[model samples]
Target: MDQGLAGLIGAVVGITGALGAAYLAGRGQREQWRVQLRRDTYGQFLARTKRAERAGKAVRLAMDSGRFEPGLYATFAAAVAEAEESLALVLLEGPWSVASSAEDVVRHLDGWRWVVELWYDGDGTLTLERALESAGRDEDRFTQELEQFTNEVRRLLHGRDHTLTARLAYRLAARHSA
Candidate 1:
C-alpha cells in the first residue's frame, strides 16, 4: 500500500472514532437531563400532594369539631387543584406506571374532597363519624399509591433490576404473612 493512502485511511478512522464518541456522549447527556426533569416533576407532585393531604386533615379536624368552616374546605380544594396541576406534569413526563399511580393518588384526594362536601351539605345522611372514617381510608389509600409511585420512579431511574428485587421482597413478605 502507498504511504499517502495509508495516512489518509488512518485519519478517516480517527475522525470517525471521535465523532462516534461525541454522539454517544451527547446522547448520554440528553438522557441524564430527561431523568433529572422527571425527578424534579415527581418531587413537585409529591410536595403538592402532601400539602393537599395536610389541608384535607384540617378540613377533617373542623368536621370533628362540628364546625362548618368553608375557608378550610376552600383551602383544601385549592391545594388539591394545585396538586392536580402538578399531576399534569407527571402525566406528561410519565412512563405510564408512574402516571397511573399519580392519577390514583389524585383520585383519592378528590374522593376526600367529595367526602368533605357531603359532610358540609348535611343532608342528614352522612354522619361526622362516617365522614371521618372515610377520610381515614382515603388517606391510607393515598399513602399506598404514593409508595407505589415512588417505587415506580425508582425503577425507572435505576432499572428493571430494582423492580425485580422489590417484587422478590414483596413476595417474600407476603409469603411470611400467609
Candidate 2:
C-alpha cells in the first residue's frame, strides 16, 4: 500500500472512532440527566408525602386527644398542597407505571385529607370517632400504596421492567377499551 493512502486510511479510522465515542458520550450524559431528574422528582414526591403524613398524624393525634389547635388543620392543608404541587413532576416525568402509582398515592392522600377536612368543615353532623376511623383507614391505605409506589420507583431506577401484573393489567384494560 502507498504510504499516503495508508496515512489517509488511518486518519479516517481515527476520526470515525472519535465520532463514535462522542456520540456514545453524549448518549450516556443524556441518560444520566434523565436518571437524575427522575431521582429528584421521586425524592420531592416522597418528601412531600412524608410532610403531609406527619401533619395528618398530628391532626389525628389532636382529634383523638380532644384538642383542636387552630393551626394544625391549616398546616395539614398546606402540606397536602405542597404534595399535590410536587405530584405534577411525577406525572410529567415518570414512566407510566410509576406515574400511575404516584397518582394513586396522591389520590389516597387527598381522600384522607378530604375526610379530615369534612370533619372540620361540615355542619357538625360527623362524629369525631367515625371521622377518625374513616380517616385512619384512608391513611392506612395511602401508606400501603405509597410503599408500593416507592418500591416501583426503586425498581425503575435500577432499570427493571414493569411488573408482570402491571403489564397484564395494562393489556387487559387496553383490550377492554378497544
Candidate 3:
C-alpha cells in the first residue's frame, strides 16, 4: 500500500477505536450511576423498614406482655409513618416489581398497625395473642417480599436487562431457581 494511504487508514482506525471506547465508557458510567441510585434507594428503604419493624416489635411486645410502656405506641406510629414516607424513594428509583413489593410491605405495615390498635387492649375478639401472631405473619410476608425486591435490585445492578422481556425471563428463571 502507498505510505500516505496506509497512514490515513491507520489514523481512521485509531479515531474509530477511540470513539468506540468513549461510547462504551459512557455507557458503563451510566450503568454505574443507575446501580448506585438503586443501591442508595434500596439502602434507604431497608433502613426505614427496619426502623419501623423494630419499633413495631417493641410496641407489640409491650402490648402482648401487658407492659403498657409509655412511649412504645407513639414510637411505633412515628416509625411506621417514616417508613411509609420512604416509599416515595422506592417508587421513584425502583423497578415496578420493587415498587409493588414495597407497596405490599406498606400494606402489611398498615395491617400491623390496625391489629395493634384494635386488639392492643386485649378486649376485642382479636386477642393480644392473636394480634401478635398476626403481626408475626405480616412480618414474615413483608420480609419475603423485601427479599424478593432486594434480589431483583441486585440482579438489575449486576447488568440484568431492565426491559419487560428481560424481567419476565428473569422472574421465570427465579421461579425455577426457587
Best by the TM-score measure: 2
Candidate that scores best on lDDT: 2
Q: Output the TM-score of candidate 3.
A: 0.74
Per-residue alpha-carbon lDDT of model 3 for 4-53, expressed as tens digits?
99999999999999999999999999988887888888878777877777
User: Per model, how many backbone clashes are there?
Assistant: 0, 0, 0
Q: lDDT (0-100) at residue 99 of candidate 2?
A: 92
Candidate 2 clash figure, as a count:
0
Q: Encode model 1's per-residue lDDT on 21-71: one tens digit a residue.
A: 999999999999999999999989978887897788778777888875899
By lDDT, the better pick of 2 and 3 is: 2
lDDT per residue, candidate 2, 1-178, as tens digits? 9999999999999999999999999999999999999999998998898789888888989999999785999999899999999999999997999899998888888988898889999888889999999999988888777777877987899866456654465346435533
lDDT (CA) per prediction? 0.84, 0.86, 0.75
The 10-residue segment of model 1 with minimum total lDDT is 169-178
- lDDT for 178 in candidate 2 is 35
Instruction: For model 2, state the Cα shift of residue 99 in Å.
Output: 0.8
Candidate 2, position 101, lDDT: 92
Against the true structure, what is each candidate's TM-score? 0.85, 0.87, 0.74
Colliding pairs, model 1 = none
